[model samples]
Target: MSLYMLPLAIGPWQIALIVIIVLLLFGGKKIPELMRGLGSGIKEFKDASKEEEIEKNDKKE
Candidate 1:
């Protein structure tokens, strides 16, 4: 029996290539808008989780 292992290393060139690809696909202007949307979504999710925790603690008392 043989087991295969995938490489798990990322170097600077690999990162640069990925950035180039993303820029090409999304364009320079749309990238900032996409990032802003993603950041807001993450913030909203965290806020919702915090509210749920607060409600749970109140119910316990």
Candidate 2:
């Protein structure tokens, strides 16, 4: 058996609405701080993954 999934059809208006909602929820002043924290979290996740890969490689050799 196989399962199929359909992707969401998001248009420009949908995107604009989402942006407006986020802006209203987070406010302009907080967006930059949120983005900075998000970026740092992503960087830390990548660094951890790389370290795990290196450890696996070291264990095999």
Candidate 3:
């Protein structure tokens, strides 16, 4: 029951409002481009992490 420790739980109405705001701010066309860039960035991060783990295991062996 700690206000500072726990993140606020978003309800469905809050989510819909947030989505509306994002649409207003970024517009319809830019959202897909932003999502694509975000997806690629995440993919690159995952690939880098896997490579690092493989390298660490090789060094240990």
TM-score versus the correct structure, for each prediction: 0.80, 0.85, 0.88
Per-residue CA lDDT of model 3 for 5-60, tens digit only, reads: 55687789899999999999999999999999999999999999999999999999
* Preferred candidate (TM-score higher): 1 or 3: 3
Q: Each candidate's lDDT (Cα)?
A: 0.92, 0.91, 0.95
Q: Runs in model 3 with CA error above 4 Å?
A: 1-6
Write candidate 1's Cα lDDT for 1-61 as tens digits.
Answer: 2234335566789999999999999999999999999999999999999999999999999
Candidate with top lDDT is 3
Candidates in descending TM-score order: 3, 2, 1
Q: All predictions: root-mean-square deviation over Cα?
A: 3.5, 3.4, 1.5
Alpha carbon deviation, residue 47, candidate 2 (Å): 0.3
lDDT of 1: 0.92
Question: Which parts of model 2 are misplaced by more than 4 Å?
Answer: 1-7
Residue pairs with backbone atoms closer than 3 Å in model 1 (clashes): none
Q: How many Å off is the CA of 22 in candidate 2?
A: 0.5
Going through the candidates in the order shown, the clash numbers are 0, 0, 0
Worst 10 residues of 1 by lDDT: 1-10
Residue 12 C-alpha lDDT in model 1: 88
Model 2: per-residue lDDT, tens digit, 4-48?
Answer: 332466679899999999999999999999999999999999999
